[model samples]
Target: MIDNTSLAVVAPEILLLVMACVIALVDLGVKSRLRNLTYGLTLASLAAVAFLTGSEAATGETAYGFGRMVVSDSMGNWLKCFSTIAMMVCLVYGRPYAGDRDMLRGGELFTLAMLSLLGIFVMIGGHNFLVIYLGLELLTLCSYALVALRRDHTQATEAAMKYFVLGAMASGFLLYGLSMIYGATGSLDIATVFKVIAGGQVKHTVLVFGLVFIVAGLAFKLGAAPFHMWIPDVYQGAPTAVTIMLGTAPELAAFAIAIRLLVEGMLPLAIDWQQMLVVLAVSSLFVGNLAAIAQTNLKRMLAYSTIGQMGFVMLGLLSGVVNGDPVFARNAYSSAMFYIVTYVLTTLASFGVILLLAREGFESEEIADLAGLNQRSPLYAGVMAVTLFSLAGIPPLVGFYAKLAVLQALVVSGSPFYIGLAVFAVVMSLVAAFYYIRVVKVMYFDAPITATTVAAPAEVRVVLTINGALILLLGILPGGLMTLCAQAIVRMLSS
Candidate 1:
């Protein structure tokens, strides 16, 4: 029977579910070109969910519900809160772009986005392997629909097919790995699996075999190297609005599940998994940076850049355990958390500029499309430049501090090997800077293709400005967020 505590633990999720259904029905009657009613309802629901999750996170509470199949904890709640806000921002930036392209004729975009967010919430809260898998499927299915929303666009349909095929394979790999763990441990619950593995009765070889598949599946989801084949194609082919939806908030969910499966469930095998992460990280950095440098399409370049960024996130994850000691686990995971948060923040602004410049019947996707952007509108050009600089790890930017935090985590581990990894990451950052700065140079140095000033709605201008400001503000005062992440991770581990 569901008790008050269990119901309270899932209050936000329940509200989201009811509101998503209501919005879908309400959208059926939304005849406005912008679907103003649906959009407003969706934003209101997201804001309410964010508040609930933020309050729960602030309390630093951990509660289990649904027969311990799900957990409500500070780390999960905070991630959920951030994901909700990211979705809200994504919708705000995407609506205008979608409307211009006639992609907002119906309210499906708003409805699908909300469902996708609900799936993210479930994934973050899942404490059982089956529950997590279910959430993963839900999110992926909705994402596939969202990508294919523009029925007449061949590129959109093709991207959806590719995303669907690859996403299914990854889900299978994850499920098969989870089944293997269950076979070895006789339990599907994460806590029970942890106890079982820590007890050392399971066959090491069997567990390791399953781990290989699990990491591959996770690598695919995180857009890490060797498994990031679909990212660039999808990002380039899908509508810009869909791309933003796919890229931003889903990342936080991916990170949370990684923490759940690898850190919470299979941490006793740290030596084994950390070695795998090192290979993934190194390859992602090497391929992501070098490949990004060769790309002429702005979206594809950013896709490769994402792969490299995930490399740093992996560095933080792999550095958590040193010589079988988890003394640095909190610091390491928290750094990864902080890195992803800031990365998402910067990404919103970067893509917001791209979406803003893209007008009807024209896709502003190529690097040359941004020529003399500074001349067209200094405000947007400045925002884009700040975003690129932050991504390149320049000083006095949030990305720099994020990189610094992860590097500091590695160096503090006091391992020669980790220190070497830190050095390698720095070199990769330098390689990445070249491409990023090249974009800025194009914006400032190249002649304007058209002298018309870029125009955006007041809402977009306000949101983009606030987003860019946060990137700089957080860089200057990252301590609060850093401390929040550290506290959340500590609470998670202790519970």
Candidate 2:
């Protein structure tokens, strides 16, 4: 029986859904001058959802709804809260950019973004394979549409098609893998599958085959190397606003689903999946760093940087279990969760600046376009510099602490192979630093490429400042958020 108690577990999602429809309908009557109303309402809805999620997380209770297909717990709630804030900040940063490009003409961007967040909520809460896949499709479908929203732009259209085609293929890979697991285990519920696998009766060959495809699907979604063909194209071709959305928030959902399928549902198969993740991590670090150094376009460079970041995230995940011991699970997974959170924070600020520098008829995507950014807008330039330094894992920045946590987790495993993985990750970080620093150099040392004053809405400026400050603050005082991540993971595992 679906009771009020069960329904309350998903109250935020329900509220968000209703608000989304309301916003879509309200947009119909809003004129361009009054379009801010629609944007304001969207922001308001996100804030409310965040509040609800935060409240739920504060209770420190884990609840299962819909026959355990959906869960409300610390990890999921915190992720939802952060994802909402990320989207809110994204919309704030995206408004001027969208308005200048006429992408806001029909209020579709706002609606689509909210719908995507709903997908994120679903993905985070899902505890069943079908439920998770439904969420993934919702997110991907919304993303494909948003990428192509600039229907008149050939590049956007092309990028959208590529994303759709590749995304569909990945989905098929994931579905086949899930079906194989079901056939082997006789269930689709994640907990049931885990129990079945733990029973030691599943066919080894079939399970391994399914694991491979599942990892491929996950790699594609996370934009890890060898499966990351879509990221650069999509980031460069899509509107910068949409690119920011693509880069930041969906990542939280990806992390959640990874935890659900690999950690929560397939821990018995950890040795197998761990081997796969190691290869993905190594290739991602190697390719992502090497490829980024050659990119002149800022967005494309960031795309490659994202690939490297995902590699690090994977490193933490893969190192969780060694020799059938799960002693390091909490540390490793929590580090990964922290890494994703910090990465999303830094990414939002990095892309936020790119979006801010974009004027009408100008995309500001080229690294050269940021020449003399220090002279043109010192404040924004500083913000961008902080973010870049953070991404490079420079000390006294949140990104550095994020990296340290993961490396520490890797080292804690006491496995020489994982220790070597840690070493390689550090080397890749060094290699990746060159491209990141190059952006700062261009901003500070080169002459201005454009003379127009770089002005943005006050809200964008305030949010960017806060975003940049948080990156620095969290880096300097990493204990609080680190503890939060650790606690969330502990709760998740315990429940």
Please provide TM-scores, in order, for all candidate models, with all chains considered together. Answer: 0.99, 0.99
Residue 376 shift from truth in candidate 1, angstroms? 1.0
Candidate 2, which ten residues in sequence have the lowest lDDT sum? 28-37
In model 1, the runs with Cα more than 4 Å from the true position are none
- Give the alpha carbon lDDT tens digit for every residue of 343-364 in model 1: 9998888888899999888889
* Prediction 2 global C-alpha lDDT: 0.94
Q: Candidate 1, residue 11: CA error in Å?
A: 1.3
The whole-model C-alpha lDDT of candidate 1 against the native structure comes to 0.94
Model 2 residue 86 lDDT score: 97
